[model samples]
Target chain A: MPSIRLVDVTKRFGDITALDRVNLEIEDGEYVCVLGPTGSGKTTLLRLIAGVIKPTEGEIYIDGEPASRIPPQERNAAYLPQQYALFPHMRVIDNVAFGPMAKGLSREEAYEISKRMLEMTRLAWRMNSYPHELSGGMQQRLALARALASGAELLLLDEPLGALDARLRVELRYRLRELVKDEGLTAIHVTHDQEEAMAISDRIVVLRDGRIQQEGRPIEVYREPNSIFVANFVGGANFLEGFVHRRLNGSSIIQLRGGLRVRVLDTRFNLGERVVVAIREEATGIVPSSLKSKGGRGNLLPGRVRDISFLGSVVVYEVELVNGEVLNSKVPIQMDHGRFRVGDEVLLSLNPEHLRVYPYPPIGLYRELEAV
Target chain B: MPSVRLVNVTKRYGEITAVEGINLEVEDGEYLCIIGPSGCGKTTLIKCISGIIEPTEGEIYIDGELMNGVPIQERGVGYVFQEIALFPHMDVYDNVSYGPRVKGWDASRMRRLVDEMLNMMALRDRMHDYPMELSGGARQKAAVARALSSGSLLLLLDEPLGALDVKVRIALRRELRRMVKELGLTAIHVTHDQEEAMAISDRIAVMRAGRIVEVGTPQDLYLNPRRLFTANFVGEANFMVGEVAGSSGGEVEVRVNGEPIYSVRSSLLSSGDVLDGGRVVAAIRPEFVVMEGTDGMNSGFGGLTDGCGASWGGRVRSEAFLGSMVRYEVEADNGVLVAVKLPSLSVGSGFRVGSRVTLTFPPRHVLLYPYPPEGLERAISIE
Candidate 1:
């Protein structure tokens, strides 16, 4: 078991800063995923932790010991890149045994260790097969087996599932996480996919432009993002600007720019203070319009379904409010076919608690995607 | 107004059959998407309809007129290619008006037509921009504008939004569907992505191995797919091998590994009509399976005979929180079944990876099918 720490680590390449003063601490057996868009320095962070590259500034600590002086080999960490880099000339078993044999183990001893690792990764049958003979997912499994053959406590993977298809990726991610936990190993994975990171990580570190945007548990980060970029990146949500209009009991009632008032959890803003609301598309549901408006009791806005789309598991509807602002709602696919159509009147209902009110962002919502 | 019809269309390359006997109808003002896995003959079928490759057999009709011995130009159909094959040398305005100009239209008529098409596509401001000067999305918009500006009643689109990113593709698909309806054009789109086909089209025709396996509205195909392939293709589903033990009291009970599993009686039996001792396969979508926590779990059962629908002593295998939804795998009886739930719909904290739970779903959520002639999994396995 080993804990890892990085204190204000910075890396630079001439005029460009690769990573800007990052601080991270991983517990002994935690699975942490560093997630971000491409060019967000995810690989750079992993490389620095693996001791392949030295940080321009700050300290690297491993298990309470400063690792600035230790060589890459003695760090006892294994790194797997996007592509599985197995020995082309050797069989899968030989590749997995290579790490153990390099550490002065006899041929028989190395093979014995390789057998156990292969079985753990569900690659026992493929041990005698060459890397080229295995499917994409099988080759990835072989890579994992090789990484763990060294008996390393910390495993670092950089987009290990990037090359697989959508369905295969989903299945392999769970197996990978399960294997890592079953072996009681600490894993830090890096990927650009939001779903992959959320599905497997105990904690997520979201990065943007050489800086850490947010860090927390996957559900926490997804449900309550601290920044506009984090919210938009993790899940697509519609942003609405409004101002606090009233306060009663423990809630604050806000008036949207479209002249509709909504009640939300109390915030620090004073009366008439401008704020922004973030609503997940799935959090809203639809009811037919011409129904009585349930104002003051809860949140309900009258709108007309402008468009309808079937997205497999979910049915999406683009509805235009009476004030002419369009909002998207996603509901589960109906068994009896579509329950609504284009040009139908509907009332959008969402609990006030599901409506997130935050201080108006400096970059604003429209410019967030462009900034990425 | 044009209605496209394909009667027993089949195309062969030398000795290999690229498309086999696909019979389809695209009603006037309809949007139909042909979807399947890669190498499923989707492109080959589209090519036959586009007249790029004439069918080896069968007749093609457009607006009730036979199109035999006719070229693409005479068929009066517009093709919006996925590769955005715009002329790099010409500006958007010139490119869009090229069709009418080549067809021998006057300058004033061409200008009026191109102007209206550009305005509807929101490419008027970028009309003077060249293909290289525009972004990928902009270039795609220009190509669509050019295709529609030709005044063709029928449009054949080959994955028009396939080349873009996911978010951009979704936004553009909405706009593209709206425009197609607003301009009143009949569209037949080809795509390999099931979600894209579901989102944009009025009906979907699923293909496999040069064969059109199924065709229906998105709702009909997804909720009530008759074939095993269509059940797995349209959405996420769980397949279990079982035997039809009996039916009674508005409920059909099947035996999975010698344990009775109850599904609602409203089923179209595909495997066999005999209610007793008939081998069968049951398909259930993950979203419909309901997982109740261990405490007071049995108190919910109000109307059931012989305790058939209730499955107890199930343990959670794994859990994944996928943004909009959470998926859970549970081990019950002899197999691992999945259930998908929305956080809002669940009560309190949901089941963890190792918690005990009960699994049940009404019969309407399940679809039973007879094993195909090839094998039980042949239709489900894309590989």
Candidate 2:
């Protein structure tokens, strides 16, 4: 049996559907992240798994046992929240040991367990300090230590590092994963941060409007998202509206709305079928329109630079194609800086390997394209 | 005239010194960003400049005029806060026009100005949308337009884009910069994000414990930092211990783990900066180090002769796809793990863990700082 399972679980807050028929399965010791922006019902899903809330319709099972039959306290799952969730009045050690002590461990045993968890989170030095005395990151680590000290095989984290700085978030996310795996814990973390979800999770469950949009490995969702939402949400993507023109050599030739032809793999489309071709911002290389690139170019589109911005490690060039299709290319900072400017004509070479083709969405596909 | 100047500024709250004595100059129409970690007094410095709070012991000047006693409004400075404070009842158009209306501008002029500001922010289409109906990014743009509508001589922004998503922040920061530069509005922005500071600023002031540690262009801070904090804060760097072996012409030979490593002697440093056999730290960006012959689709790197990148063999320890860049941790022969960053575009990230490869980089990107550096541990805390 999977460690946890959700069979068409749905939750409603009066009229609004917070989570709509969400189905998922978490294997033993697997790290899964429920990722979505605000109002996407990520928290509702985590709460449902921890038995904190009941589904308006459908079932949830933990360890092959129906979860609704179990009370929240009997779930034996540790829940850490975005608010640090530490006892402000208690010292760090006591807060971490609170779980073990309440779960019937001896005083000495609880202390011992807390100490080990603290060391794992690098919060051993602050064991004697109160929660308010620690930095935001330190407090977050303390919360993780508390969750680990509880001896729960399943750990549920809700936006665990939302309050920390960017640098601190990067450093602690890996540490959190290490602590979870080393303890042989099955974890389900929820967050809105795309980078945070991609950095630590073994599997990502993308949710929107109370339903699972897509679920896959982080890289899979990023490089080849199954839908338009996943592509734009996980990473920056360029969407071009096109139709399948023909099939040749195990690939489909796509014709853009402007009559430019490009080749793409995965031949699951019919002739003249309208599709949206998704290309990642970093997959395209830019060059002056006058010079041809040595890299084999299968799809070169000429465009005038519409906008360019310096982003420290990278430069983002927003090129508007001659046919008025806007595409973005992210060039690394190490590349020559003065290559292209606004109004300068440039050619974007798109590699076919990075192209992802999907049937045009039923509604609001154009709206989402502009948002991406 | 200089847009703003801080002379020996310091702010103390009770027994704690929020900002130490600091001096800085902002040129007219310059986008200067002040950045540091929490408790570093970035907020206090911004407040002192904007007259929200008084500096305990220093002088502030705006446009060459002594502004020590000038009121916040009379100082001709517009301060946008971290959180968007839109008038809840007003629509986007009215919220933007509120500034001009408050200044008693004629109805026609106010309407025209609001339209222009909305067009510049790309919010003209959403001019009729309420605060609740707009996304966080749109609301933020409305707030920026409102600040711009005030038409102050100087703009003080305190992490205005801090509360948005990564992609939204990236998009809005550039727009903010474009609007600021197009309007020729001198601005001072404060943020804890090094990337944000580097992206939008004409110059950056790195703060530590409320004091100005260093101020320079983003390229200067990224390429040749005067201190370890500035280097690590602005960008990712691999810090390794080394000793100066010999110097000749434009290159200096530094020894790391008994291996000769040539580094370009930075013209920014004093000529006698490093003496022979003196210990120092070599800081280099991960992207500067080139991994040799990574030809497969996994990583499109290939064809580098021995002398191209001061070469060394290393095994791939681990790798991660950080969206924009692929980070590979390589364990060198000396038992040190060097992190290399490759653009996520061309490189297919085919490098597998445990693969053997050679690593090398040009001597010019290497930065050698004095060993046993003063306050280095405190400045660039790895934790």
Candidate 3:
């Protein structure tokens, strides 16, 4: 178990800055996920911590030692890249055992350790099979088992489950987190998938333009993101431009473009201040406009259903508000039918507590939400 | 637009039969998706439809016209492959207009079509960019737009969005479907992503072991799959081995690990009558499994909570928060591992690891089937 600390780390490639003065600390046995869009410096941060690449400025400390000068092979770290290379000629058991045997353990001791790692990854049944005989999912697990059996306190995983099938990817994420927690190992995972990060990581660090935008627990970052980019990237949200109109007992009323008003559970903004209200797609509820009486207590806005997409578990309805703004509402598929058709007028309900208000950025809303 | 019909189509590569006896029909302007795991012949089936490879046996008809020896260009079919294949020397505009140009279309009409296609794919800003200058997702989107602008009445795509990011893939898949529907083109899409298939396709064909196992609407395949393989493939479902104890009034009592579990008989979507004392398997989707904390106000019997409910004690083994849903794995008292998915709104007040809970499987939600002859594990295996 080792803790990692980065002090003002910066990495530059000629005119391009890959990482810029990032400071972070990871406690022992903690699993931290670095999440970002493409070209957001996620991979660069992982490489710097893995000792594969040195930072251009500042220092990196692993287990309370200066690790910038250390080479990758001597860092007591196992780096599993996106494309894992397994020994084709060796069996699954031998592939995992090779790591321990190279550490000068006896053959029996190495095999014992390898067996336990395989069991944890659900690969023990295929221990006698060659790498070529296993599926893509099995090969990934084998690579992880090999890394774990290497006795490295720190594991750097770069999109370990990128190549898996959709269903297998979901199943493996659970197993991966369980193995890391059970072994009490420190892990830093880098991926462009927001859902994967939210599902497995104890803490998520959102990166953008070679810098850290926000860092917190998965739920905190998802529920209350500090910036518009973090909120949109982690989980897609419906954005509405509004201004603080009035304050009501720790809550604030926001006025929209068409003079429509909505209530939010926030009072940090002053009256008449411009702000944007963000609501999660799933948090928004929808009902037919004819049933206006059923809209009990909440902010109900009249809209027409423009489109509906059934995503198996949930249905996403795109409703065009009377002001011509489109809001998406995700509803679970509970019954067989009775879903709103495309032309039906509907009422969108936004609970005050679910709406998060943020001050308008210097740049426009679209520019601030851009992933690039 | 033309309808496509494949009658007893089979493709063989010496000793290996890639696809066998695949009979499928695509109605005019219908959007059908063929989905399966790798090596399940989904790709091979799409290739056969695209006329890239001649089937070893059977007949293919486009608009009731025989197409046994017709060339791909004469078929009037647009093909988009999983792999990137764009003209290297041409820019995005030229590549999208290639098909219309070859057909001797006028400049103004061709330009209008190309512009519309580019705008729909969000590649208008990159119209002058070459394939090498675009990102992976953008290149794939361009490839799709090129195929759509070709004026082909039939479209056959093999995992067109497989290489895109998750967010991009979701957005592009919806756009792709909308364009196909608006243009009134009959399409057959092949992919391994079940969610993508469910989201866009008018009908889904579940392929397995070089054969079309079942074909139905997305809702039918997901809720009332005729085969156990489809239930395991389309979504997450928990299966328990049991023996049928008795049946009455559409409800069957199954003995799972010596505990009585009630399930719906008609939910099996089968014809045969279930015999008592016969081995059976109970399947339930995670969303249908109701889990309640034991410390809550109401307490019921450990065995049966009501007339149609079967309750059991369990301990939460693990929990995964998946944005909209919270999935929990529980170890039941009968030694069966059950998965339950609840809306994430209840996450804060939900059961945690090692919390004792009551898992209730409503009879209406439980599906019953005769234990697969090949065993439950083999029956549910995708490979």
Q: How big is the RMSD of model 3?
A: 2.9
TM-scores of the candidates, chain A only: 0.88, 0.87, 0.90
| Sequence-dependent TM-score of model 1 | 0.84
Model 1 lDDT at residue A43: 94
Task: Return the DockQ of model 3.
Answer: 0.49
- Candidate models: Cα lDDT each: 0.80, 0.82, 0.86
For model 3, name the residue pairs that clash: none
TM-score of chain A of 2: 0.87
Q: Candidate 3 lDDT, tens digit per residue, B261-358?
A: 89764455343536777788889888777787887822222223235478899899988777877788999999999998876765564578899988
Per-residue lDDT value at B290 in model 3: 73
Worst 10 residues of 3 chain B by lDDT: B297-306
* Candidate 2 residue runs with Cα over 4 Å from true position: A100-127, A135-137, A243-261, A266-273, A292-297, A334-338, A369-372, B245-250, B253-261, B265-273, B292-315, B344-349, B373-376
lDDT of 2 by residue, B252-303 (tens): 7777887666787345445565678777777788887777544423233333
lDDT (10s digit) by residue, model 3, range A128-183: 99999997877988998898899888889998877667776777788889888988
Model 1 misplacement above 4 A: A1-4, A11-14, A46-165, A185-188, A247-249, A290-294, A334-339, A369-372, B7-18, B51-136, B265-275, B297-308, B333-336, B343-348, B373-375
TM-score of 3: 0.94
> TM-scores for all candidates?
0.84, 0.91, 0.94
